[model samples]
Target: MDVEFLLKMGRTKGLEGVEIYKVETDSLALTISNDKVKEASASKTFSMGVRGYVGKKVAGVSINDENLNAEVAFEKLSSLIKTSIEDPNWVGFPPPRKGFMNIACRDERIVHADYAEVMKAIKELMEIMKDEAVRNGAERASVVEGMVRLGAQKITVANSEGVHTEDECTVSGIFMVLKTVAGRGESDKSFWIVNRRFDFAELEYLGMNTARLSLMFAGAEKIETGEYDLILTPETFAGILASALIPAFSALNILEGRSPLKDKLESMVLDEKVNILDNPGMPFEIGSRGFDDEGMPTSAKVLVRKGVLKEILHNYYTSARMKLETLGNGFRRNPSSPTTPYPTNFHVQPGESRLEDLQQELKKGLIVYETIGQWMSNPYNGNVKATATHALLVENGEVKGPVKGVLITGNVYEWLGSRLRGIGREVFTSEGVATPGLWVEKVRVAGE
Candidate 1:
C-alpha cells in the first residue's frame, strides 16, 4: 500500500492531521494430530488502518483489502469523526524522532523456511518426546497434538506530523501436547517454544522436558490445604506478570483511577531486592522493537528500581494529557485498534540465586510450573487466584512427587513485598514477559 498517497489524499480532503498504519504478513502453519500431519497451509494478508483528525475529534478505520479504496476509508473516518465527542486536551500526533536503536528482529532462516523444513523439525521434535518418555520409564507415550507456525511481517506507520517508520520481524513457534502412561496411570503435559529465530535446540529441550514431566506426573496427588512456601517457575511468574502486575503500570489506568499505583510513584512498593524494567531494545527477542505503533522511538526505561515505583507506561494520548513526553509505549492491538499504554518486553531483573538454590533454601514448598485461569486474577486490587495444574511437592530439598488441583490465592503486593524469599538467576521469556522463578513465603494454598 502507498502510505504517502493516503497522506496526500487526507490533506486534499481538508483533514488537519492523518495517520496511516499498514501491515503485510506471510505465514505458514502445520498441524499434527494422532501422530500424523493433519494440516499444512500458507497464507498472506494485508491490512491498512487510517486515522484522521478534525479539530479536537479523531476517528480511525481499518480495512483488510489488499487494494484499498482510500476515498471510501477516508469518508468513513470523516463521518465517524464528525459524530465523535471532542477532547479539550486533544493534541496533534507525535513528530518523528531520530536515532532509533539498531536491533535485528528478523531471521532469514525463518523467512525462507519451507514446509518440508518445518515438517522435518516437527518430526524430530516428536521423536525426541517419544525417546525421552521411554527413557523416563513410561509404559506408553504419544504426541497427541501439535502445531508449528512461521511468519514474517512488515509494519509501517506514518502521520501528517512528519512521523514515518518501518519495521520487519520474523516469528517461529511450536506447541505440543505429550501424553505418557505409566502402569495404570496416565499424564498429559503441554509445552510451547517461541522465538524470533528458528531454534531446534530449544525445541529439543522443550520436548524432552515435557515428556519427562508427563511421565513423572502419571500418578499426581493432591495436597492438604495450608499456607505453604511457593516457588513459581519462570514461565509461571511470567504469566502472572503479564496478566496481573504489568497492567497496573499503565498511565491510562492511573489517569482513569483504575490502577493501584497511581499514588505510589517513587515510593517503595516491593522488596528492596526487586527491580523491573521495560526494555524494547533487547536484541532478537520476540517483543523487541525500535519504535512503537505511534512512530515514536523506543528506549529502555526502569519501571521500578530497588522496589520503588520509578515510572509508569504511557502512550501518546495519555502522555499528552498529562503534559509529559511519550515513553514510546503507545501500542495498538491491531492496525484498526486505538493506541493504549502497554509494556514492551517488560521484565523483572534476575537475582543471583538459582532454582536449585531456592528449592534447597525453602526446604519445603510447592514448585508451580503451570497454572490455569491466571488471567482471571484481579489486577485492579492485586488479588491473585489461579489453579496450579502442574506442580510438584518438594521436601528436604528433594522433589517428592507431583501434586495437582491446588488453588493458589494471594495479593501481589504482599507476595512481592514482605513474603518474597528469593529470585532465580536464570531468566526465561514466555507470553511476552521475561522473569525468573520467584520464591514467595506463606502463600494460601487450598487443596484436599
Candidate 2:
C-alpha cells in the first residue's frame, strides 16, 4: 500500500490521519513419525492492514486477499471510522520521530533460502535426534513436526501531519518437537531454533537437547510431597517471570486498576539483584525492531533496577493520557487493532551464580527444567501454581531421577523477593523474554 493515495483522500473522507502495514510470508513444514517423514507442505501469503481517524474516533480494516483493491480497503476503513464509537483514549496518532537506529534485522540468507536447504536442516536435525535417542536407550524416537519459516514484511506509516516512515524486515526460524518411548515409558519435548541468522549449528543442538530431555524423562518417578528448595531453569523462569511482569508493567493495565504496581512505583518489588529490562535495540534478538508500530524509535529501558520499580512501559496514547513520554513500546498485532504498550525484548538481568552452583548449594531440592501450567495462574497477584513435567530430583548436589506429576505452588513475589535464593548466570531467551535459572527456597511442592 502506498501513502500518496492515503494522503490525497484523507481530506475528502473526513479522515484526519492514516497508517498502513503490509506483510508477506513463505514457509515450509514437514512432520515426522516413527522415524520417517509423514507429511510435508509449503505456503505463501500476503496481507494488508490500514488504520485511520475520523473526527476524534479511530477505526481499522485488514485484507488478506492480496489481490484486493487498496482504494476500496481504505474507503471501507474510512467508512468504519465515520460510524465507529468515539474512544476518549484515541486522541490521535503519534507524530513522526527521528533517530531510529538501523540494525541488521534482515538476513538475505534466510530471505533467499530455498526448500532444499530447509529440508537438509530438518533431516540433519532428525538424524541428530535419532542418535541421541538411541544413545539414551530409547526404543522409539520421533520428530513430530519440523518447520522452517521465512517471513518478510514491510510497514509504512503516513499521516495528515506530513509524518511518513517505512521499514522492512526478514525473519527466519525452525520449530520442532521430539518424542521418545522406551519400555512402556514415553516422554515428549519441544523447542524453537529461531534467529535472524540461520545457523545450522544451533539447529543441530535443538534436536539433541529435546531428545535428551525426552529420553531422561521417559521413565520418570515420584517423590514425597513437601516444601523444598526449587530451581527454575532459564526457559521456565523466562516464561513465569515474563508472564507475571508483562501485565503488571503495562500502563494501560495500571490505568484500568488491574496492575499490582499501579500504586507501587519506585517501590521495592523484587530482590536487590533483580533488574528487569525492555530492550528493543538488541542486535539479532527476536524482538529487535527499528521502530514500533507508531513510527517511534525504539530504545532500551530498565523497567526495574535494584528491586525498585523504575519505569512502567508506555505507548504514545498511554503516555499522553498519563502525562508521560512514550518509551517506543507501541505495537499492534494487526493494522486493524489499536496500538498498545508491548515489550519488544523484555528480560531479567542474569546474576553471578551458575546453574550447577545453584544445585550444589541445595542439598535436597528439585531442578525444574520445564513446566506445564506456569502461565495459567493470575499474573497480577504473583500467585504461582504450576505443574512441573520434566523436573529432576536432586540429592546431595546430584541429580537422582526425573520426577513427574509434580506441582509447585507459591507466591511469585515472595519467591523473587525476600525468599530469593540464587540466580544462575546462564540466560535462555524464549518467546522474547530472556531469564536465568532462578533458585527459590521453601517452595510448596506436591508430589507422589
Candidate 3:
C-alpha cells in the first residue's frame, strides 16, 4: 500500500494532517490432537488504519480490503470528521526522528519455511515429549491437544509530517496439553512457549517439563485455607503483573482517573530491590520494535528503580495533552484500534536467588506453576484474585504434595511492598513480559 499516496490524497481533500498505519501478515498453524496432526491451515491478511485531522477535529477509519484505494479511505474518514467534535488538545502528528536502535526481530526459518517443514518440526517435538514422559515414569502419558503457529508480519507507518517507518518480524509459538493416566485417575497440564524466533531446544524443554508436571499433579489434593508464603513461577507472576499492575502505569489511565498510581509518582511503590524497565530494544523479544505504532523511535527506559516510581507510559496523544514528551509506548491492539499508551517489553530485573534456593529457603510455602482468571483482577484498585490450578505444597524445604483448586487473594501493592521476599535469578520471557519467579512472604489462600 502507498501510505504517501494516502497522505497526499488526504491533503488534497483539505485535511490538516494525515497518518496511515498498515499491517500485512502471513500465518500458518497446525493443530495436534491425540498425538497426531489433526488440522493445518494458512492465511494472509492486510489492514490499513487512516487518521485525518481538520483543525481540531480528527477522525479515523480502518480498511480491511486490500483493494481499497487512498481516495476511498479518505472519503470514509472525511465523513466521520464532519460529524466529530473538536478535540481541545489536538496537535499535529509526530515528525520523523533518528536514533532507531537495531534489533533482531525476525527468524529466517519461520519466514522462509513451508508447511511441510513446519509439520516435520511439530512431529519431532511430539516425539520428544513422548520420550521425556517415559523417562519421567509416566509411561501412559500422551499429548491430548495442542497447536503450533508461525507468523510473519510487516508494519508500516506514515504521516503528512514526514514521518515514515517500516518494520518486519517473525513469531513462532507452541502450546500443548499433556495428559497422564494412572490407574483410574487422569491428570492434565498445559505449557506455552512463544518467541520472535523458533528454538527447538526451548520447546523441548517446555514439553518435558509439562510432561513431568502432569504426572506429579496426579491425585492432587486441596490444602487447608490459611496464610502462607508463596512462590510464583515466572509465567505466573508475569500473568499477574500484566493483568493487575502494568495498566496502572499508563499515563492515559492516570489522566482518566482509572489508575491508583495517579498520585504515586516518585514514591516507593515496591520493594527496594525491585527494578522494572520498559525495554523494546532487546534482541529477539516478541515486543521488541524499532518504532512505536505512531512512528516514534522506541528506547529503553526505567519505569521503576529501587522501588520508586520513575516513569509512566505515554503515547503521542496523551503526552501532548499532558505537556510531556512521547516515551515510544504508544501501541494499538489491532489495526483498527486507536493508539494508546502501553508497555512494549515490561522487564523485571532478575535477582541473585535461584528457584531452588528460594524453594529451599522457604520453611513452608506453595509454589504456583499455573493460574487462571488473572485477567479478571482489578487494575484500578490493585486487587488480585486468581485460582491456582497447578501448585505444589512445600513443607520444611521439601515438596509435600501437589495442591490444586486453591484461590489466591491479595492486593498487588501490598504484595509488592513489604510482602515481597525474593526474586528468582532465571528470567523467562513470553508475551512481551520478562520476569523471574517471585517470592512473597504471606498471602491468603482459600482451599478446602
Candidate 4:
C-alpha cells in the first residue's frame, strides 16, 4: 500500500524502480420479484487486487481475502515478476508530481451507507417500476435485489520517479426486467455515490426515467432508411464517445497506426465547441483516483480543443517510446496491462442551450435516446450505423411520438464536428463520462 515500500523492495532486488497498486472492494447486492415465476435474492462480494512492477516487468495477483499480509503478497508478486518478460521500452516510472489540483476522491455517503439502507432503496425502486409493469399487464413482475457497500480502497504507489496516491469510493445500484405480453423490456442502471455530497434526487429521477423509457419501447417498429437530422441525449452519447475516444487517445493504438488521429496532433478532430477533458477528481466517479495504476498523478488534459486534436493519453511505456512525459492516463486491471493508457473520468464540456432549445431546433429530425451494439460499432472513420431502441420522431421542432427499431447511421467525428448543430446545457454524469445533449444534422435513419 506504500510507494516507498515498493521502491525499497525494488532497490533490494536490484531493480531501478517499483510501482504498486492495491484495490480492496466490498459489495452487497440484492434482487427481488413479485412475479409467479421469478424469485428474489441478495449477495455480497469482497475482493482485493495487487499489482506491482519490477523495472517494467509487471506481475499481478488477486485475493478475496484481505487478511493476507502485504509482505506475503509482495513476495509472491516478486516471484512472479522474475518470470515475466522485460518491457524493452520501459522508462522506470512516471513523474510523481501533482498538477491542476482537483477534489480528492472521498465520499461521506459511502462511508455511512449500510446494507439495510441499500436494500430498502433497491426494494423501493423495484416496487415502483414493477407496479408500472403490472399496470401494463406484464405477465411476470420481478425485481432484482438492491445492495450497498464501499467498492474499493483504491491506492496507487509510485517511487521518486512516480506519483503515489490513495482514495476510497462506493458503488451500488439496481436493475430489473419487465416482461409484457405486448412485448419485452429490460432496464439497467446504477448509482455511484462517490462524492456522497450530492443529493439523491437526481438518482431517483434517473431510475424513474429509465423505467418509463423502457416501457415506451414495447410496441416498437422500424423506420424507412433515409437521411435525417439526429439529436443525441447526454445519457446516450457518453458510451458512444467512450468507445470512439478510447482508440484515438490510446498510445499503443497510435503507435501501431490503428488510430486515425495518429500524427494529427493540433489538427481539428472534433467540433470547435467540443472540449474533451480527463479529470481524475470528477465529483462522483468510481474511476476517479489520485494516481494511475503506474503511480502517475491523474490530471485533466484536453484531448480536443476547438475541434483540434490536442493530446493523447499516455503511460510510462508508451511515453518512453514516444519520448514524451507520461500524462498520467496509465491503467491496469492487474499487472498484465501495466503502463497501458486508460481514462479516469472522460468529460465533454457543455454548451449554453437548454434541452427545450435543442428540441426547438430539431425540426424534421429524429431524437435517438438509446442504441444497441454501440460498443461493437466502429468510430475510427467517424461513422456509426446502429439500431436504436429508444427514439422519437420530430417534426416542426417538436416530438411527434415514439418510434422504435430505428437504425441511425452517421460519421461520428464528422457529424459531431461539422454537422453537429447544437448542445444542451443539461449535462448528466454516468459510466465515468459526463456529457451534454447533442444535435447532429443529416444522419441516415432506416425503418419501416
Candidate 5:
C-alpha cells in the first residue's frame, strides 16, 4: 500500500524491487431468447498480484484474499529471488510520471441501470425479432441475453527505483446473443457492446444484425471448391490477424527465438496499405487503460504504419532484459498465469471501399465466412490450412449461395501483404479494433 513499506521490505529481504497490483471486478449478465430466459448470471472477484525482482530473477504471486500473507508472499519471493542472476541489460522501473490519464470510460447510468429494466429490454428485443419474421423453421426460436459489467480497479506500482504510480478507473460492458433454431440446425449469433460512455441503445443495431445474419445462415449449401479470390469479413479478419500478431507481440517468443519478426525492425513487413495501431487512449475503447501493468504511460502507438514495421509492446521486465525502454507490457497474475508481452488494443486500419464496393472488385472468388481448426495454424511458420465452413461462392462479383466444406490454405503473410487486393469500408469494431472486410486476390480453395 505504501511505497516506503514495499521498498523497506525489498531492501530488508535482499530483493532488488517489488510491485503490488490489485483488481476487483463486479459483473452482471442476463439472457433471453425466443422470449424466454436462457441464462442469467452474475460474478464478482477480488484479486491481487505481487512481483519481486532479485536482480535478473523475477517471480510473481497472486492471491484472492485481501488478508494475503505479505510475509509469506515475500518469503516465497525471496526463495525464488535467490535464483535471480544479474544481467547487464537490467534497467529499473520507470520514473514517476506526472499527468492525469484522460477519463473516457465511465458511466453512472450503467451502475444504476436496474435488473428489471435490463430484463425488460432483453424481452423487448426478442419480441421485436420475433415480430420481424425471423422464424425460418425450428423446434424453437428465441433471443438470449441482457448483460452488464460494472467495476472499479486500482493499481499501485512502487519499486526500489523510487518510482511510484497508482491509477483508478471504472469499467462497464454489455453483450447479447441471439439463438436461432431449425429442426436439427441450431445456430447462435452474438454481439458484444461495451464502453464506459455508451448506453444499451448503442448495442441494439449490432444485436439485431447478428440475429438477422444467423437467420440467413439457415439452409446454407456446401460450396463446390476450386481456387478463388476471397473477401474476409471483419470478424473473420480479426480472428486470423490476432493469431498472426500474438506471436509478434510476445517478448518470451522473441527471446526464445520463436518470433519471425525478431530483429526485423525498419523492414517493410506488411502491405503499404496496412496500418496496425494499438492505443490505450482510443476514445470509448474498452481496453484503453491509463497505465500499463508496469506503470508506464499507456498511449496510442503505430505498430505498423502504412505497411512499415514500427514497434512492439513491452513491459518493464522485457524492456529491461531487451535493453529498451519499458513499454509497459508486463503481466503477472500472481502465479495464475505467466508474465509476458500482450497487447491492450490491437487493430488494423480501415480501407476506403465498402464491403459491396470491394465485392464488386472481386471478378470471381469465394467468401469464407467461418473456418475450422484455425487454432492449429502455426504463427511461427505463418502457414494455415483451415476447413472453410459456411463459405459463399462468388461468381462474376456476387454471392450465389452458401456453400459448405470449403478449404482455404495459404501463408498468413501472403494473405496479408502479397495477395492483398484491397480493403473494404464497413468496419465492424469490437474490443479496441475496428476493421472492415479484407479482400485478397487469391487463396488456395479446394472443394467439390
Candidate 6:
C-alpha cells in the first residue's frame, strides 16, 4: 500500500496530521503431553493502525485485513474520527529523531530454527523429567503440559512528522508443567523461559529445576503460625514485582490517583541495596526493542538507584501532559488503543550474597516457589495478598518439608521499605523481568 497516498487522503479530509503503524508476525508452536507431541501449529498475522489528528481530537483505528488497501483503511478511519473527543493535552506527533539506540534482541538461530528442532528439545526435556521422577523419589511423573513457541515480528511506523522507522524482533519461549506422584501425594510445578536468544544448556537446567522443586514438594509438612522471615524464589518474586507492583510505577495510574508512588519521586522507596532498571537496549533480553510502539527511540534507564526513585517511564502523551520528556516507554496494547507508559526488560540488580548465604541468613522462614492471585494486588494502597501454593518450610538454616495453602499478606510499599532484606546473587528471567531471591525480615503468613 502507498503510505504517502494514505497520509495525503487524511490531509485532504482536513486532518492536520496522520500516523500509521504496521505489524507483521509469524509464529510456530508445539505442545507435548505424556512425553508425546499433542499439538503443533503455526500462524501469521498482519495489522495496521492509523492515527488521525485534527487539533486535539486524535483518533485511532486498526484493521487486521491484509487485503485492504490504504484508501479503504483511511475511509474506515474517517467514519470513526467524528467520535473522537478533544483531549485536554493535545500535541502533534513527534518530529523525526536524530539518532537510534543500539539494541541487540534478535537471534539468527531463533529466526531460523524449525519446528522439528523445537520437537527435539521438547522430547529431550521429557526424558529429563522422567529421570528426575525416578531419581528424586517419585512413583510416576508426566508432563502435564509443555509448550515451545518461536515468533518473529516486524513493526513499521510512519507519520507526517517524517518519522519513518522499522524494527524486527524474534522471541523464544518455553513453558512446562510437571505432575509427579510421590507416596500418597501428588504435586506439580511449572517453569517458564523466554528470551531473544536460546541456549539449550540453560534451557535444560531450568527445565529440570521445576521438576526437582516439585519432587521435593512431595514431602509435605505443617508449620505453626508465627511471624517468620520470608524467602521468595526468583519465579514468585519476579511475578509479584513484574505483575502486581508494576502498576504502581505507571504514570497513567499516578495521573488517575491510583498509584502509591504518585508523590514519591526522588525519595527513598525501598531498601538501600535495591536497584531497579528498565531498558530496551539490553542485549538478548525479552521486551528489548530499538523503538517503542509510538515511534520513539528507547534507551537504558535507571528507575531506582540505591532505593531512591530515579525516573518513571513515559510516553509522548504523558510527557506532554506532565510537561516532561519522553523516556521511550510508550506502548499500546493494540494500535487502536491510546499509547501509555510501560516497562522494557525490567529487572533488579542482584547482590553478592549467594543463595546458601541468603538461606542461612534466615533462621525461620518459608521458601515461596509460586503464588496465585498476584495480579489482583491493589496498587493504589500498596496492598499485596497471594496464596503460596508451592512453598517449603525452613528452620534453623535447614529445609524442612513442603507446606501448602499458606497466605502471604503485606503492604508492598511499607514492606519494601521496612521488611525487605538482601537479594541473592543469581537472577532468573520470567517473560520480561529478571529477579533473584528476595528475602524479607518477616511477613504475615497464615499457616497451621
**lDDT digits (tens) for residues 1-448 of candidate 2:** 4567756766666677776655666655566555566667777776766778866788888867654676687678877887889887677777777888886677676667776776676687788987898898889887776555666656666666666777666666667778888874888877764555666776677677788877777678888999989999887777777666677788888888878888888999889989999987666667788888777888888889999998888888899998887668878877668777888888789999999888887888999988878777676777888899889888889888889889888887888898899988988775567778889999999987
What are the per-residue Cα lDDT tens digits for candidate 1 across 372-414?
9899988897889999999989988889999999999998888
lDDT of 1 at 416: 90
All candidates: CA RMSD (Å): 1.6, 2.4, 1.6, 4.5, 3.5, 2.0
lDDT of 5 by residue, 47-118 (tens): 766667665676666656555666777787777667756555555555655553674554555555556776
* lDDT per residue as tens, model 4, 211-264: 455555555556667888888888678767866655677888888777778899
Instruction: List per-prediction Cα lDDT, in the order shown.
Output: 0.87, 0.77, 0.88, 0.65, 0.66, 0.80
Query: For residues 1-448, could you state the per-residue lDDT of candidate 3 as single tens digits?
Result: 6778778888999999988889988999999999999999999989988888898888888888654766777788899999999888788788787889887898888899899898888888888877777787775878899998899999999889999999899887878998887653688889886778888787888887887778778778999999989999998999999999999999999999999899888999889989999999777778898989988888888999999999999988888888987568889877655688888899999999998999998888899999999999999999999999999999888999888999999988888888998999988898889998889988999999
Q: Number of the top candidate by lDDT?
A: 3
Candidate 6: worst-modelled 10 consecutive residues by lDDT = 65-74
Q: If the candidates were sorted by their lDDT against the true structure, best first, what order would they fall in?
A: 3, 1, 6, 2, 5, 4
Better of 2 and 3 by TM-score: 3
Q: Which regions in candidate 4 have their CA more than 4 angstroms from the true location?
A: 1-17, 34-87, 98-102, 127-152, 158-164, 173-199, 211-215
Q: Estimate each model's TM-score.
A: 0.96, 0.92, 0.96, 0.80, 0.85, 0.94
Worst 10 residues of 3 by lDDT: 65-74
Clash pairs, candidate 2, are none
Across residues 118-184, which tens digit of lDDT does each residue of candidate 6 receive? Answer: 7787788788977877688888888888888888888888788887889898888888888999885
Query: Any residue pairs clashing in model 1, and if so which?
Result: none
Off by over 4 Å in 6: 66-72, 219-226
